[model samples]
Target: MLTIDSLSHRLSSYLEPTQINRVKRAYYYAEQAHAGQYRRSGEAYITHPLAVANILASIHMDHQSLMAAMLHDVIEDTGIGKAAISHQFGEQVANIVDGVSKLAKIEYETQAEKQAKNFQKMAMAMARDLRVIVVKLSDRLHNMRTLGALPAEKKRRIAKETLEIYAPIAHRLGMNDWRIEFEDRGFAAMHPLRATRLHASLQQVRGNRKTLVEKIQAAIELRLQRESIDGLVIGREKHLFSIYNKMRSKHKSFKEIMDVYAFRIIVEDIDTCYRALGAIHNLYKPKPGEFKDYIAISKENGYQSLHTVIIGTQGVPIEVQIRTKEMDELASRGVAAHWLYKSSGDDDSASAGSYDRANRWIKRLLEIQQHTNSSVEFVENVKIDLFRDEVYVFTPKGEIIELPAGSTPVDFAYAVHTQVGNTCVACRINDRPAPLSQQLESGQKIKIISSEKSQPNPNWLNFVITAKARAAIRHYLKNQRHTESVELGKRMFMRALTNNNLQFDQLNHDQITGLLEKTTSESLDEMYESVGLGRITALTITSILLPDSDENRDGTGITPISIESPDSLLISFARCCRPIPGDPVVAHLSTGKGVVVHREPCKNVSDLRSKKESLSDISWSPNVTGEFLTIIRVEVKSERGIIASLATRIANTGTSIEGIQVDERDAENSVITLTVAVTSRVHLANVMRSIRNMRSVTSVGRPKT
Candidate 1:
């Protein structure tokens, strides 16, 4: 049904004669490479690539992109190599083909992993040349079109990936045509029954509404004509996937959604576009607060238009959009639009601006990639940002920043810069003090209050919505843990050395190198990190350095490490027993969690003590200066102001109530669970005594498991 000659004829309208010839040459080369190969549908394999090239041509892609589309599958399907493609076509075309080819040389444990790795490879290639994604998108479009020959399960997998990734990517790049096509086909393949039912419903509704829709279109056309505003008026068709989504997401009947008539008015230029909008509003009163001027503040994807809702004739609602011809074209082709690839003048500034915005999005993906170590983690982080509903907020300086809805100041901080996010301690929204976790709304000005001594809180990950912010927070915490672990391991080894009377300064470079090799560690720092993370013990390494057979011995008479700094990243107090200052505690070496301190009598520590290598003796330092969290349970007689009175009493103890909950309640007695911060065990006892003095409080004591 398709051929190279047919595509060449179509390309002749815009592409040069030489460029068309080059595309033809690439086609013939691909044909020879796969001479005897046939596709699953029993057609010549060459047809697929040719179809892909045609798709690219429809967007008027440059010659190199078309050529790359033609030879995209040659390296994967045939014995041909990338070097041959490079030699035949130019290096740029070959690189694109390689980028688009399926990289399935190695075995993978699961489908998701394989997909993530392949996507990661493609993302790298995409960063190198933006055209690679354009060609790859075309290749995927052709595959999706021909997926009927595949098994049902395979079809669903491909369809899901297309909807989850490719379609959203197309939308983000401003390629509305490809994105809609992808969504419609992917939806159908993924849910054939639902799609079939929705399509039939749409067909029935279209027939019933055809007359009314035409009448509305005609009315708008007449108004524009009378106003001397030249424009093209046409009713817009709702894609099947969009209609289905609206039905499900909005929980509306098909008829309710169909009731809204949609139309587009394409004008000759920007000024006329606004004039046409005003004329339409005068014809039918526009619904208040329903107008959006995307023309002035374009979307992050570079889409520009004026959208409005008005009460049409017969009390029906009409949704209308007005835009210039160029803007409409860009909406379809997005970054692949021919104008973006060419040189720009004052008239082409919109195209150039749109292209730059697309580049910024791609580079953001690169930043996320750099912070991720696992391909799976990277894909998971990336998926979080794919479906952003934008909320435009401004900086104090009046520059607009586009962010996803429900994004917090932490998300905004990371968006500004990674360092700003890492150092941000507080925020001022609209010049008034606000919590950092407050969700930002449109038009609000944000000012981040940062401190030089601040570091990212791991808790930020629970609230920050953007992929960039989450990744940066994770990156900082992970690196911080490693640095702290190494320092703790070195300190532990120093204590071991003091006990053995072996000085760390006395060890030579060769001795340290030998010790690292003995542990199969790459460097001395890595061995220390291993020790700190509990992978190996400090005493073991100290014995290796001294070889003093008695030094490796475990148990009694060793000086316990003083936990003077309770807030050390390497030392974490266990929650189960909640051991505070002056409590007798023992430390357990948890792999990857440097040290976990538990009360000496804790049930968990009973079994852990048998493993001598894992258990260590630890003591609290005098004058430790941090608040420790402890839970206080109180049984109170049924009365008013019980919770408020307890909160006040807790606050009167020179501290504040951290949290409060009612665990169990009856008509006579109510159990109140209060989480309070105290300086020490003595301070906690005094708070409990103060609460016990209240008459409503029947009993007050600490709860232990």
Candidate 2:
């Protein structure tokens, strides 16, 4: 039912005459483009754009934004092209329109992929120009308003999308009014019975509490007046969706949910907001530990307020929010408040600052997209970042850093800078040394310690919470694995050549080039890197690179040995026995996993030996060399020098003790477990024998595998 006249009238209030004419021109052009098209509701398609434009006008968006909203669907639904829009309106308008357009022409594997792709596109577009999202939000708002025309299945799908994505986006942007409306509408479409019951309950509650709410409002107003603080007191109704969420999350019934009747007090300034809080507290007792001051530390979405729970008449618990006029405007309208201030010729700096703060997360999404190539992964990460509650911590310099709740020091390091995260070695929380995975709390000061030689630990990914940290860590680990794999591949190839008595100097450029081409690698280095990364087995590459005569020599030339590499990254030793080089070994070809080598006598190996199809014969190569892990149990007299003597004897036998733990201690004797690094099983036995020769040592033996 919306018309061009209503949109024009709305625009006339803030837009200049020329700008209004431009918007009008876009309207007429869109009408012509959709002359024969009708919506599912049997209205002219042009009405949809007009309604969308009206929504933007209500938010006082700029002329360019309004034009984009009007012409948003033209590129996707009509014959009009982006070039034509650019020629007619300008690049900015054309870009915004293009940004909001969906990729309907392209085919996707599934509905989820298509949706993820669209959201990814929208996220990228919003990063470039935030106006695109504002316009898209307006477009979706009109669509949702008229969603009844669609089939039930489609309605549920769109409503679910709105609830999960659009509503959260609105909340992130500080558009509380739009966010609440979206949630309510989506809830009605997705769960009609629940929505109806909740609505009825809310209405009944309102009817029963009308008098009590009025009394509380009057009391708050009178207290503010008595304190000489000018304020506007209003009853704030709880949204049904929010109530439903609380019920579901807290497992509470409708009647059990308190704070159903909330109130807000909008004052003249920040100081007056605090004074109003004090006045209200004087009039009504505030509940213990229920006050929050957001004025000093605003939310990630730029919302600021003073929140407190108070016991009002009849001992009813009521939630109260106090904020200044500007803060209230922001709490209601969010980023839309920027347009309102701009159109009124208010301070540009304050508006820009607010917009920048809200835009930071959107910009971060774009950065994450650059590192993430999977549509599903990008969508999941975006959801994680959007839905979690945030915690505020501080840097060593006292600057506040906001992160998701349950974030760790590693997440903090990445939030500061990518390089800092890559090089982070350790961190201190609250001036005390803390683990990198320590869950950060609000108000704690964090100082990251970095070393140039340090690289990201793959284990960090297990606990990191933020998208940036997760994506950055994964990207770095992937690259690091490639680098190590390439080096290992090169070394394996050399060992193959040595076993065949064929030196690298014997191979000509043509042979190397042929080898690279056969492996589908760009260069020799890439082939080696691939081998090291386990993409292609070194044995396979060695067979291809060596002559048939060399290949026929004993299987010893290519036998898998000492899964360990120079960097200790290409292979991992099974923790069951911590196998050394001299132990007989077998490799298990796990699906989607490279070969895992285990000692032949290991209990785990014994259990898996039944699956002969998955087991491959492996042994230690003559050239194999690296430190191996082993545990030793030692029982000694409970004397001070006994511990030092055991360590000295072990060191004398060329073994290094990595760690030691006392199993038991008494007045005469003690038991200790030592994790030692040795070159081979023989080396470990020698060290154990050396320790056993000591007078204080009652027993020395390898720990049970």
Candidate 3:
């Protein structure tokens, strides 16, 4: 029964006569294009597009969006080209239409990949023009509304995707109304029996709920009247999906979930909003710790409201939300509210903030896309960023930072900027030193400690929840490996050149080019990377460059490279030997890992010695700085607080305990294994001597590999 006539009449509310006429023309064009096409329900396909346009009209979307909604399927279903739409409408409308068109299926991809690719392409479109996604969302909503005509398997698939992706997208955009609809409808289609039971239960309680809500709504109304506050009072309507989600998440029964009566108080201005809140609080005593002032600090989606709970008649809890009319609409329509106020000349700073917030989110998605390894990963990261319960923390300067619940300092650092996250080595919460992995809470102030030598640890991926942090860390590590590989390869090649009585700086361009060609490397850096990764040997490059220099490969020819910093990406100290500064160490060429340092006397080094190509002499510089992990065993009597004593002693020696484990030796004694941080052998010796002198300590020695 829906038609373009009703939509056109509604459009006349704000749109000019010319815009309405253009929309009508687009509708008629789409209708003619789909003359005989029918949906699975046997209804004319034109009805679907008309219904989609109606939904956009409800949001008061731009006239162009409405036109695109009408002709969105024309390009994909009717085989009409974008050129045709462009010739009819303007380029903007045509582009929106093309963007909303379903992509032709790409061959040779699995179903998951196909879905990821589709979402990736759609996200790019969303970044181009926000209207494209708004139109596509409206189209999806219409399809979801009439989903009963779909087959069971197909219906479930569509419902699942809606709940997983579309619903979250709506929530992220602050489209509360559309999000609730999407979730409820998708829930019904996915789980028919559960939805039916929940619906029936709600119907049974509707009478009592309405009565209670009305009684409390009247009390708030009378209080506001007495206070001379002009406000609109309305009882809150509970959505089925929200109710079900509450029951599942809170593990409560239907009665418990429905116990609290809810209402909304919409005032004329911000001052009146606060006045109305005071009036309501005077009528009913407010519950402590149940108030949130979101108006002062808007949510990430720019939702603003003052929420509080009060004890009402018969001691029953009443939940209320107070806001201005604009806030109320912005809460529901979200970014789309920008257009709702556009033609009315009501585009204020608040609406602009909401629109800009949504744009920032979309921009972040594009940034994550650049660093992601695959479309699947990008979509997964987007999904991670979509659903978040925010915690508001503060910076040292009193600026508020909002992050997802359970976010750590690393997540916060990346939220600030990529460079901050990459270089941050420590954190202070509330002016006290705290572990970087400690979960942050609301209202706490954070300070990040950064060092130029610090790099993002691969282990950060284990705890970082934000997409930006994960992507940036991965991107940095990927680039860092290449740089480290090049550096190591350069040193190895220089050593080989030195042994052959050749200076690398003196090599002619022709000679370097010939060597690169022989090594199948297109550039000098490529040859370095190949050698660094162990894909090709440094000796091979030297042999090819100087064919008569085979005799230069002697043990004495290899020079020792000073490893000032073992923390470099390519130079890692082997855990087996736990090499610290002042230890005689050798660089073991490890494929894919570059150089790994092992103590000379380590048993593992003896095995690697047979492969002379893998061996390169190395040593620590006197100025070597940074903590190194080493294991030490302490034989101690089982005295009370013996482990505590050892920890205190280690700290007194300026050595930090990374780990502590107890090994029960007998009834009266225990072997304490301590993994401590040390600068060099002298530092370790000082720590050992400090521990050995303790009364509980019988002996102290480093564990040899």
- The candidate maximizing lDDT is 3
**lDDT for each candidate structure:** 0.85, 0.82, 0.86
Q: Which tens-of-lDDT digit does each residue in 194-263 have in candidate 2?
A: 9998898889878887888898888888888899999899998888898999999999988878445699
Clashing pairs in 1: none
Error of 2 at 87 (Å): 0.6
**In angstroms, how far off is 329's CA in candidate 1?**
0.5
lDDT of 2 at 618: 64
After TM-score superposition, the amount by which residue 120's alpha carbon in candidate 2 deviates from its true location, in angstroms, is 2.1
Instruction: Give the local distance difference test score of model 3.
Output: 0.86
Query: Sorted by lDDT, highest first, which candidate order results?
Result: 3, 1, 2
Residue-level lDDT of model 3, residues 94-124, one tens digit each, is 9898888853332223388888888888878
Residue 293 Cα positional deviation in candidate 1, in Å, after optimal superposition? 2.2
* TM-score result, candidate 1: 0.93
In angstroms, give how far residue 281 of model 3 lies from its true place: 1.3
